[model samples]
Target: MAEMFSMLGTWNWLVLGLLLMGLELLAPGVFLFWLGLAALLVGLLSFALSLSWQLQILMFALFAVAAVPLWRRVARRNSGASQSNPFLNKRSDALVGRVFTLEKPIVDGAGTVRIDDTIWRVAGPDAPAGSRVRIVRADGASLTVAAD
Candidate 1:
């Protein structure tokens, strides 16, 4: 078994890298891509030079150290400048700045407002039912409203 494992050479590493890359398609995140690149580099280096086990370990460690920070920097540059849609994954965020009519009177700073057939708990200065209110902000399932 040990001999069979030892027989795996540079080509095996290359194949492993391809497998990792293929897995990345199934689970698309930033992680496996770097590891696969490292493996591919190691395979090419092993093919070019007869590397000792210590050199192989050192190469893998160096690849990890270098690739992680570089990948993070690239990822941040790609993602940081863009504004994320507030409505993305949060449907209530779309209600901000929209106007609604109070369905129930706000007594002691709490009331309900009907928005698209759903009554949402609201907090604002005291207001009567049927008053026009604008959504100032959303807190969980509740809307912080103000007189429109």
Candidate 2:
């Protein structure tokens, strides 16, 4: 184990980095990808000069410090991209501003509506079944509604 650690070369480190990056495609998370980049930088440094163990460790620390924050920024931007996609996982909020007809009358502040083949619980002013309603807001899985 010690010998393997000591004998690691620039190409070997580069290969390990590529492997980690490939694994990130399957994992789809930010962590391994940055560490892989850090390892690749270490490999490039190793190829450029003969470094002592302490120097190698220091270089890795610096790479991590530089890469992690940059990776986090990119990940944050990518995650924010989903907010612009209308069909993303937002259930109730997606329903607001959409129109639906009540499948069952709203009596005592509760009823059901068929919205695109899905029945959802609704809260609004009393109305008979088949009346048009517009979703005003959403609370969890339920929608607050008003007459259309």
Q: For candidate 2, report its TM-score.
A: 0.66
Tens-place lDDT digits, model 2, residues 60-100: 77887898779778879998888788658777787889898
Strongest candidate by lDDT: 2
lDDT by residue for model 1 over 1-148, one digit each (tens)?
7566556578877987888888999999968878888878888999999986566657867886799899988988877555465466676788999998999999999999987778899999999999999999998898899999
- Runs of candidate 1 with Cα error greater than 4 angstroms are 1-8, 18-32, 44-58, 79-96, 102-119, 124-130
lDDT of each: 0.85, 0.86
Clashes of 1: 0
